[model samples]
Target: MKKKITLTGKILLGLLLGFLFGIALKQLPSGYIKDTVLLNGVLKILGSGFTSAIKMMVVPLVFVSLICGTASMGDIKKLGRIGGKTMLFYLGTTAIAVITALFLGSILKPGAGLDMSNMVSGEVTIGESKSLVDIILNIIPSNPIQSLANGEMLQVIFFALLTGIALNLVGKNAEPIKVIFESANELCMKMVNIIMLFAPYGVFGLVSSTFATVGSDAIIVLLKYILIVLLGMIIHVTVVYGGLFKLFTKQSIKPFLNKFTRVAAVTFSTASSNASVPVSLEIMEELGVGKTTRSFTIPMGATINMDGTAIMQGVAVLFIAQIYGVDLGINDMITIILTATLASIGTAGVPGVGMIMLSMVLTSVGLPLEGIGLIMGVERIIDMFRTTVNVMGDNIATLIVSNSENDLNLDLYNSKPLKKVA
Candidate 1:
């Protein structure tokens, strides 16, 4: 009998092969046959199509799962407590992430020996960011249907929470509606599973296309900055999150990480926390986080829990300041952490949004905005790792909150041989 390859193994194989193939493709002559036919043709279709397929499930999964999770709670106070815990954990972790990055940046000095000439000269367009008051106001959707259609996650979340609370309040009268939502939630998970069956192929296409286009020149240029940022990510996950997992849940981090590898792979490949929500929820279930906790925390985390982005912002801020010969005091570090943590709340979980938020953070500290252009060359690759860390933070938060709420199944978490999902 042959040993079977798990989904994680298959995905890893795809990533490896895709990388080698992409490097090979990069070496080929620049012509229609190589560029138009292969890179833009088949690879584009496969990568884009797979991304679209998974994204198609995000709205429905979030809306339905959140409703089911919220309505099942039965106690509004419990729901509020859960929400509070989730927010606290998210914000705390994010602040810690930034501080860690700042510390690493200060010591390792990734920006040392680099001059302004290294800056990529391009017009960096900063997105129109909203005021704190405006951000709060925007969460209340004027039109729920429009929010869903537009994938306005914060608004969608607001509406879903209200709907779920209402359904829970109606009690016996809303039983039928609750049943429908419960059924819908299961259907959505099943759909996610079906789509994920093609994950390896999707991973291959996406990775290959990205590598073929990006090449390695940018990586070589910003090697130090990239390494320090990656180091910060590793420390946050292994030390901070790991410590929380042990202290709170009293479970080994190994199992949590084992169950989460698939989710991490999906997130890394896609580089969109929103796109990885379905996989996150599925993996959360396998990790024994109850629907009530996982559903709410995961989607909310996707939108707001950006520990990964916070890490990037902190390192980049220090890097930018160092390159410009700007001395940041303790006050500046605190501001970076606070600004990045709050900014994470409204930040969308997509590629390159980190750059936008980084711009915002830099402005807060009066760092030169041109520093963003310096790191733009390597942002795509870093975004992949940043997203993986963000998703991991979400899962860890879910576990902690679920355990506190008595919603975690320790037996299920510790169980070997995870139940096979499609």
Candidate 2:
């Protein structure tokens, strides 16, 4: 009998193989083979299908998880307090993430040395920027069903929270609905396991397709930008998250990091925080968080908490401004941080969503909007890294809130040794 590899092992293998295959595709002599047969055909479908599978599960999983989590919280006042803490932690961390990116990007100056004589000149399609007033109004969701159908996360989150709160208020009368959601949440989690079975294949297709289409010129040019975003994410995830776990909670971060390895692979492959919600919830519970905490933090985190995206946008503002030789004063820098942090709440978890939000950051600073095209070639690859950080942020928030509420099961978290590290 053959020995079975662990899930993490399998995912790492897939990532490695996919990376090598992508380079191989890039090395092909003519564009025809990559364009006509492999990239355009096999790789395209596999990549699209995998993302679609993850996306298909997102709405159902979020709705059920939010309902179940909210219903489980017996104390309305405690629930409200948890909500406030969650919002503070998420917003504060996002601000910190952007600040880190701004500080680092300014020092690194990734785009400062670039020759901008050959940039593609065209108006990039940036959706209209919403005023703070507009954002507040839209949160009410005039038609929640429409929001659900369109996958509008902010509105969807608003609706889910209300439904859960209402269910809790009705006492035993809403018990049946809550029970239905609990079962549905279980079913949805099972779907996450089922979908992840294809992750290796999906990773292969996603990596190969990305590299094949991007080619060499763009990769070489944007390699520095890629490295900058990656380093910033690492710093924020490590220093901010790891530091917080050690400070307020005083718990070993080993368990949190242990569970994150698997979650990271999926988030990195799919590049969508929404798609990663089910897995994050599972790991949060496994890491000893009670139902009361995990349910609310995880879903809300996915929708509005985007530290990683904010980091990217902050770094992007500096990179573009440096490339265009635009001089931004302290006021502009502050504006960039504020705008990027706020914009992160509206950004989705999908790949390249950072760039869309980055456009807003640029416009806020009077930087050239088309500077986005300069980095588009490599955004797909960087998306994988930032998303890993984003999901990590959500899990971190859950852990923090759980510890504070004394709802964490430390023994359980310490009981099971990680597969790779005990």
Candidate 3:
């Protein structure tokens, strides 16, 4: 009898193979084969195409799923409670994540002996920081159609929640609209299923192109910084997230991690939290998270719950400070924690968001923003690991919320083989 490899297995294999292939491609002299054919031609098309396909599903998936989730809750108060819990978990975990990163960065001293003289600094662009009032108002969506078109996730989430609530309140009269949303939700999920079928090839392309393009000299110079950021991510996952899971759900962390392996692979490759939203929801469903909970929590978490980005920002702040010989006091660290936590909510779920959030934190505490230019060398690589952490945080939040509301199906969660997609 022949054994069948699951999608997770195939995706992991693709990731490994892609990394190795990228390393190999790096060895080739700069030429048409390395720069044009393999790097730009095959890898670029497959990876970009795959990522575009995944992104194509995000707006619709988030919109339809949230409506289905909110409307299905059947109680406005319960929806509010779930919303409160989700926000608390996201923001609280993010604060803890930054603190953990700062602690490790301080103790490990990843930047103590860093020599910044020879390193090349890239031009760093920082966006204008929004006030709290502005951010709050922006969530209301002045024009929902524009929000959806522009992919303004927070605004879209706001509109979807309102629509779902109205649909639920209208009772029988809303049944037709509700049914339309349900069908649209199913169709969006089906699109996810189809796109996922090409995940392995996509993973290969994205990983290979990244490694091929990156300069190894920079990676070697920043080895300690790289290791520290990775270490912070690992610790955040094991201690903060894992500890919280055991504390709240009273279940071992193994099952959830096991189920999330596929999502982690995609997130690490794509390096975009929003791009992984549809897949995260699918895996959460397989883990027996109620449609209502996963639908609302997964998309919202992807947009706001940025524990991984917080970790990077925390460590980067310390690294940059040490590089610039700036001594940060307790007050600075506290400000970073608060600023990063808030920035996580405001930041979009896209690639390179960590750097933007880091800039804000640095500005808050009088750290030189030029430090961002120094760390740009290894940012892309670190982004992959941090993205994996980000989506995992999203899934865990979904599971905890679902379990608390009696929306978790233990039998499905513990089943030997995951339920198959139809």
Which candidate order results from sorting by lDDT in descending order?
3, 1, 2
How well does candidate 2 score on lDDT at residue 273?
89
Using lDDT as the yardstick, the better of models 1 and 3 is: 3
Model 1 misplaced stretches (Cα beyond 4 Å): 418-422
- Extract clashing residue pairs from model 1: none
Ranking by TM-score: 3, 1, 2
How many clashes (backbone atoms < 3 Å, residues ≥3 apart in a chain or on different chains) does model 2 have? 0
- Kindly list the per-residue Cα lDDT of model 2 for residues 1-422, writing each as its tens digit: 55678878888788888888988877776666668778878888888898899999888888777878787888889889899999999999999998898888888888887887665445567666776677778888889999889888788878888898999899999998888899998998898899888888887888777766675777788778778888888898779999998898888898788788888888887788888887888888888899989988988988778888888888778888888888778899899889888887776777778877887788888887788877776778778888888888899889889989998998987777745532
TM-score for each model:
0.96, 0.95, 0.96
Candidate 2 Cα errors over 4 Å, as ranges: 31-33, 121-123, 418-422
TM-score of 2: 0.95
Tens digits of per-residue lDDT for model 3, 7-38: 88989999999999999998999998788888
